[model samples]
Target chain A: MIALRIGLAALFLMIAVTVQTSVLTNVAVAGVTCDLTLIVVIALALSRGPEWGAIAGFMGGLLLDVVPPADHTAGRWALSLAIAGYIAGLIRRETSGSPVGPLGVALTVVLGTAVSFFIYSATGSLLHDPSVDWGEFGVRLGIAAGYDVVGAIVVIPLVMWIMGRVQPARERRRVAP
Target chain B: MLKDLGSPSRSTSSRSTAPRSAFRSAGEAPLRSAGTSRDVRRRRTVLLLVVLACFTLIVLDARRSAGSPVEPLREAAAGVFGPLESTATSARQPVDNLRDRFAEMDRLKAENEKLKKDNEDLTRELTTSDYARNRAQELDKLLKVAPAYTMTPARVIGIGSAQTFSHTVTIDAGTADGVHTDMTVLNGTGLVGRVVRTTQGTATVLLIGDRNSTVGGRLNASMALGFVSGRGEVGGTLDYKLIDPKARPKVGDRIVTWGSSGNAPYVPGVPIGVVTSVTANEGSLGSTATVKPYVDPTRIDTVGVVTGPPARAPRPQLTGKGN
Candidate 1:
């Protein structure tokens, strides 16, 4: 059962990463791409809790790091994504009722993306990457956070619904459902 | 695999040994809290180890270069994901086409109006300037003497990838297609960028509108030499220092690449942009202005990479008699 969930998470993450690198890139708003992979990691964390979230974030981040046309250090994304997962997982199963879970998911999405970009940029500067555009970085950060928040609305419930199907029936009864 | 590492069935057990409220309020507190002390310890331990592993891997990979042992894994993954990405992008092409059609028509109309005005200006100038005609005639011969380049066209696959924090476009060409770093990339209208990084099947082109980009430029009207660099905006900004700081560049002045060392990163005389505004600044350089680039860097489809020395770019219409 665990393997099945992990497999599902990995497959969805794969699709998310591919779309992120190819499709979302061209559909940028204010020069910011929708981080589909980040949203996936957040959704997965909310369903599976902190530990799994970290592991999933690691794999997703590693894939992003190795993907073609990436300009930064390989581990840069790995570290950021891992952190995002951990942060998001902090709220895993913590909220109850209708609005709370969704609010938690929304918060996770916004905070996760913002932290990931902050880490990426801060690390790049620390590494002396001159190509870092400090001027537009602030605006890009805002757009990235806001973009993920919008995507989380649909993605979070979908992931939770899928995870609900896979979990043991007694485990499902513990939550609001 | 991971769930089995911890006792999953007992955590969800309806056994009398567990408290109901622990699961009721928190949704699964017993998964962490109801378990034995060692179980909680182990769960936290696993979390720490996973995060630590990522951090350690990050440290190691950041130190490694493109030829790291993990390079093959990345390549293999790309081999799979690249095709999926291509298919998805193509499927969405028609939707993008429909959405952009009206906007594109408006742009084309504006461009047509500009071209008509330019054509009239050129005809009037050609009739009046004999010296300009002779100079152009001589320059055309000089262009003939320059090296002829072979161009391999490629389609741009992605623009402004979120994973990549740079002003670059990923093209469908790479080393396999003879594209290399520093090769000039251009579209039909004008300069786009130069190839920065290439893998087996794709290359990243760094656009001239990036803040990091620096191109030497010459004005067609005033003949003033300057450097143009990206302003981190929709267009680029031009800077002319040292030479003719006193002469203020006017609006609508055409600018072209003044050439680069051996014409590797940038070739000579490629159209960069037209001056849009010149603002006075209290400094030795005196003034600066915005430039409307010839190519729309945001929406490019087909592009060419100059694998060899490109042919000389023709001069624009000569300015009025001066200096």
Candidate 2:
């Protein structure tokens, strides 16, 4: 059963990455597109726990860092996403008694995105990546975080609902505070 | 689930043998809202291990200059996801075309009216300039702007951003199709980018708009050499800096490739863009200009990779257009 859950999470992440790279490329608003894979990892972390969150984040981020058209360093996304997932999972644990509301999810998504983008650019600059322009960092951060928060509202609940269907009935009841 | 959690026999025997078993016992607690101290310790350990692994990868990837150890991993990922991306792109293309058509309708109507007026003016100019001297000048302009090259055409399968800092596109061509790293990619309009990485079935083209991309270019009129670098936006103007400090670059000046040695990365005589504005250098030295590229890197659907440069230089044309 654990294997099945892990496999399902991996599959969901792959699909999210595929959709983000191929379909969402055309749907950019103001030259910024939301990070769908990051949201999926957050949703998985929120549904499961910190351990699963870190695992999924690492895997999804590795895929993002190495997938076709990937020109950046290999572990930048991995590091950012792992940290994001860990924090998000911690948030879930803290709010266990009360179901995390939509507003909370949106807020978490925004914070997670900003944190991850910060880590990515921070590491990028450290590595001397020429793409990290300091002048546009603030603007990119605002646009990316805002766009991801908007995407999270629609994506996070849907992922949790799908995960709930496959979960054992006892665990499902326990998960809902 | 209950057997793994409740069974004391399994946990006690395997607990000493493997840390993972201890993780399964404590970390996999499904029903417990509050985990034990052991569970928290195990979770922290897992986080630490994962973080350590990520840092290792980062250090390895960052230190490598050329021919990275991560190349095989990147290739494997591209091989696995390339077809999936292509499939998704094909499935989405029809819907995308419909949306584009709807969005293009109003813009096209205005353009059609303007084109008709421009066509009439051009027809009148064509008749008036139908002389031998004018014909030679037009032919010279064409020769100066264009040179023959063998190229392989490919369609863009995916676009990459958000995760990567650079703007790039995946084309459905690869080493199997003579696509390789550092090869120039262009469209009908002008230079698009250069191939940066390639898998068996797909190639990643780093678009000219990426801030990391810098191409050697020359002024078309005076042949002053310079470099054109991207401004990190999809439709942003390129920054052109003259190599010679005293070189004068005026607005509306055209630029072309100053071809790399062996023509590996960029070939000679490919049209780049036109100078939109000029900025004076801080000191009494080099000139700088903002150039609007002929190709819209964001909207490129089909592009050609230059396979080989022309065998010979362009010759003078004695024939007229009609003849």
Candidate 3:
């Protein structure tokens, strides 16, 4: 069952990466595209707990870093997403087992995306990448977080539903609430 | 062992002391599976190790070059994911066509207006002088020189920016199709970019609109040499820095590639853009101007890679003004 869950998460992440690169790239609003992979990482982290979240986040981030047309450093996304997943998992622990409202979910996704983009840019500047211009960071961060919030509304529930389906019946009951 | 037991008990007590009575009052839902203290410790350790590994990889890949160790890993990933991207792109073609059709009318209207204006200007120049006719023919021949080069056409299969923060596209031609790093890629309109990385079946093209990209440019009117750098936005203006401090560049001047050492990255005489604006301050290092590129980097669907330059160079033509 654990293996099945891992497999499910990996499959979902790969699809998210492909779709994000090919499809979502054309659906830009304000020149910023939504990040489906990041949302998927957060969803898995919230469902499975911190350790699982970090591992899944690392894998997803690594894929983003190495995927075709990705010319950035190899581990920048991995570092950012892993940290994002860990924090999101901590949020899950803090609000353990309690049903969160739509507002709570939106807030979490926004904060998570904002923090992740921040870390990515911060590390980029530290690494001396000329692309990380701080002058545009604030506006880009706002647009990226806003776009991701819209994606999370549709993606988070779908991921949770799939996660519940792959679990045993007894575990499903625990996950359904 | 005793100390470990004490710490776990203390941590568990601290965990239970949180204000959870309100949540528990509603109903008991096993949202979280209970884990032993060892599990918590192990999870934290795992998180630490993963983060450390990422840091190490980042530092190692910070200065990527032609022969970096990360190149193999990047190529391997491209080989694995290239097929998936191509499939997804092909499957989405119908939807893409619908979107394109909606914008087609406006684009065609704009193109018609521009062509009509050009026709009027050419007719007037033709009647004015034989020199104008010769210059026009020279411009035509320069453009015709493109077919002389060996070219490979490819379709764009993916658009990506989430990871790199730069504008880039994945094309469905790679080493298998004679596409390689530093090859010049262009569309029907004008310059697109150069290939940066390639797998067996796919290649990554770094668009000229990326902030990190810099291309040598020559002013069409004044023949002044300069460097053009992207402003980091698709369809945004490019920054051109003149090489000669004494050379004065004006707005409305055209630009083209100055040609690289072997023309591997950029071939000579490829049109880049027209100057849109110029800065007032003329520093010791020459003036700067903004250029509006001929090709809209965002809207390109297909591009051709120049595998080889023309066998012989075209004779340099003179403008009506003496060189």
**Index of the highest-TM-score prediction:** 3
Residues B1-323, model 1: lDDT tens digits: 23453344234332322554554457655554546345445545766676577556656555655555556766676566656665666666775456566885675455545543443354334323432354565554534543345666777776665334566777777788898888888766667888877767777788887766777877766657888876545433434331567777788877766666767788665667778888877755667767888787767777777776644432221111211
Find the 10 residues in a row with the least total lDDT in model 1 chain B: B314-323
Higher-DockQ candidate of 1 and 2: 2
Between prediction 2 and prediction 3, which has the larger TM-score?
Answer: 3
Better model by DockQ: candidate 2 vs candidate 3: 3
Per-residue lDDT tens digits for candidate 2, residues B1-323, read 21332234224323422442344467564433234445666667777777788888888787666667888999998898999988888778575456665575664445444433443343233223322133456545445434456677777878876446688899988999888899989776678889999989999998878988899988866668899999887575799999998888888877878677767688765668889999888967877899999887767776778876656433222123324
**Candidate 3 — which residues are off by over 4 angstroms?**
A169-177, B1-13, B16-36, B95-147, B282-285, B313-323
- Total backbone collisions for each predicted model: 0, 0, 0
Alpha carbon lDDT of residue A155, candidate 1? 75
Q: Which candidate would rank higher by lDDT, 1 or 3?
A: 3
- Chain A TM-scores of all predicted models: 0.91, 0.95, 0.94
| Candidate 3 TM-score versus the reference | 0.83
**Mind giving the per-residue lDDT tens digits that candidate 3 earns over B197-255?**
88899999988888889999988776678999998864656999888877877888778
Q: Judged by lDDT against the true structure, how good is candidate 3?
A: 0.75
Interface C-alpha root-mean-square deviation of candidate 1: 4.9
Provide the lDDT at B97 for model 2: 55
The alpha-carbon lDDT assigned to residue A66 of candidate 1 equals 67
DockQ ranking from best candidate downward = 3, 2, 1
Q: Against the hidden reference, what TM-scores do the models get?
A: 0.76, 0.82, 0.83
After superposing candidate 2 on the true structure, give the runs of residues whose Cα lies further than 4 Å from its correct spot. B1-35, B95-146, B312-323
